[model samples]
Target: MNTRSPWTVVICAAAVVTLAMGVRQSFGLFLPQMGPALDIGRSDFGLALAIQNLMLGLAQPFVGAIADKHGAGRVTLAGALLYVAGLVGAAYATDAMGIHLTLGFMVGLAMTGVTFTVMLGAVGRVVPPERRTMAFGIVTAGGSVGQFLVVPGAQLLLGQLGYHMAFIALAGLIGLAAVLAIGVAGKPRALDADGPAQSVGEALREASGVRSFWLLNAGFFVCGFHIAFIATHFPAYLADKQIPPAIGATALALVGLFNIFGSYAFGLSGDRYPKHYLLAGLYAARGLVFVLFLALPLTNVTALAFAAAMGFLWLGTVPLTNGLVSQIFGVRHLSMLGGIVFLSHQVGSFFGAWAAGYMFDLMGSYDAAWIASIALAAMAALVHLPIRDAPLVRRPLAA
Candidate 1:
């Protein structure tokens, strides 16, 4: 057994996720500047980001499989290097194609190794099952903290150093995560007491046969769509309403700040209450929040309020969803299974980013997209109701 303390593992995983998610979250802050700088339309820029989201989703299952086999630390280090390369390439990119290749594909691929799927799996393996949800929450909150702190810093960099230099600075921050990856090295030992150890193939075969697994994936798809659309287009949406750029930055920061509490609180709640019900409530709350935001007049106060309200709901699903997956399937192949669910998320993200841009261009407004998001949130709320949260009953292997 690797005898590393659970806290030590959590801290390192948290640090790695913080840096990875923080840098990724700040990408939207660049869209307004990047479009004008490259002389590209919003739809074109959105397409590039859409590709990035697609690649991120497409790569996760493979990356998760590698981490399950080879260990997370090596994969994380490689991801950090690719992340740096992608950012540096994007900084120098003069056209849509170059940015698409670097920011879209390269960066997206890099995230598969660095973000929630990998870090959460690392944390899940080390912590006891009873405490897993809270542990997952702690790690998820780290990403929110990154968003809280990093977005403002990115804005300041954009103000003082320009967008290209800002990308370089962000890349340097990701490099620091490589050092933290050392703590989560090596394959995880099994903690289940009853069942004989299962191979990755066995785990995958069992999970693929379950209907609840697909339900979880569908629910997560909604999460990706909501997050990517809001993160990528919210600032621009606010700007179109004639709000100041600072307000948009502040709104994003608030979302990050409040998400810290939301994630932690939801994680704690998942341990006591039924996670599926909590998830149902969360999506419903999102639908209600959108209704209020759209119905009320848009103001700095309303915008900030909307950001704070939405922030509390943001990423709350991550720990709960991941916890449910581990709870049902066992943690033997948690990373790979989690990645499979997240793939659906990334697919939704691709459409969320692309669709928003395409819709805005055609209709000259984001009203239609906002309404669609509201509808999806309601659908997601209902979709989680049918999941059975019991562990799979796998028989012992033949002697």
Candidate 2:
């Protein structure tokens, strides 16, 4: 029997992601400094982040499986150590290959253990079904909070200490999450004691056959693309127009700040409304936001307004998508199944991050990439329209 309160577990999971994701949100800030210093182009820098997103996706399911079998606490502790090492290594890296290996590969792998898959699974197991979406919202908001606070601080460190020292300083912040691991340290437990038992293999087979599951994946892919492209390149895009670098940082920080409200509000709504409809509306809103931003003249006011609008819509997808997964498939293997769905998101991220840079290098403007994002957002909104949120009904397996 567990002794800790459910909220205790939820809050700790939130804190860990706040640190893990907070530091990551600042990676784009490094490109201006790191790119010029190492003589690497934007494409190479973007490729490194693309690699990181790919590695992060590739490792997630295996890491999720391990967390499922052993304990999230142990997995999180090991990941935090690797996370610290990756940042420290990135700090000392002198070339593109070194950056890719440490920031792209190591940190990517490290994130699988510390971020959403493991942490949300921990929350899913502890909280009841009725409250799981709200709990997830809280955790997702924590990441945004990290974004709001750590990003500006990162910019300051860049000004005061340079990219190398900034990386080191970020490493120190992530290390603190290692101690918080104990809050989530345990194997997956029964959320509904009376619920039928399902093996991991059964869960996989059941989910694979469902149309809604695939739809969820399709929509989430666009989400990944939007996030990775904007997070990895938006600042540079602003800089290209001769906007001050500080506004770019402030803009990204505003996304984080507004998302804090967005995540919680969406989470609260998911519990009351049809999640599919909510998801569809959110995606459609993104398409509209992108279209308006592109049509308008670029300025400090426009950029910050864009950030605020996009931020509110940003991570709300996480809790809704995660809730959809749990709602349809059950949380028995959430870490693993959520990881699989997330793999699709990461695949989109790889392209989003890489393609933006590749396009910029070729075309010298982000207009094409922004157009692509708008189109993809429309596609995501359409895909989620047909999803049915009811749970799968399965016959009990033979003993």
Cand. 1 TM to true fold? 0.98
Per-candidate alpha-carbon RMSD to the true structure: 1.3, 1.2
Residue by residue across 232-324, what tens digits does model 2's lDDT show? 999999999999999999988999999999999999999999999999999999999999998999999999999999999999999999999
Cα lDDT, model 2, residue 235: 94
Say which candidate scores most in lDDT.
2
Predictions in order: lDDT: 0.90, 0.91
Residues 1-399, candidate 1: write the lDDT tens digits.
446788998898888888988888888889989999999888888888889899989889889878876778888999989999999999999999998999999999999988999888888877888899999999999999999999999999999999999999999999998888788887665552224577778778888899989999999999998998988899999999999999999998999999999999999999989999999999999999999999999999999999999999999999999999989987767788999999999999998999999999999999898999999999999999999999888787889
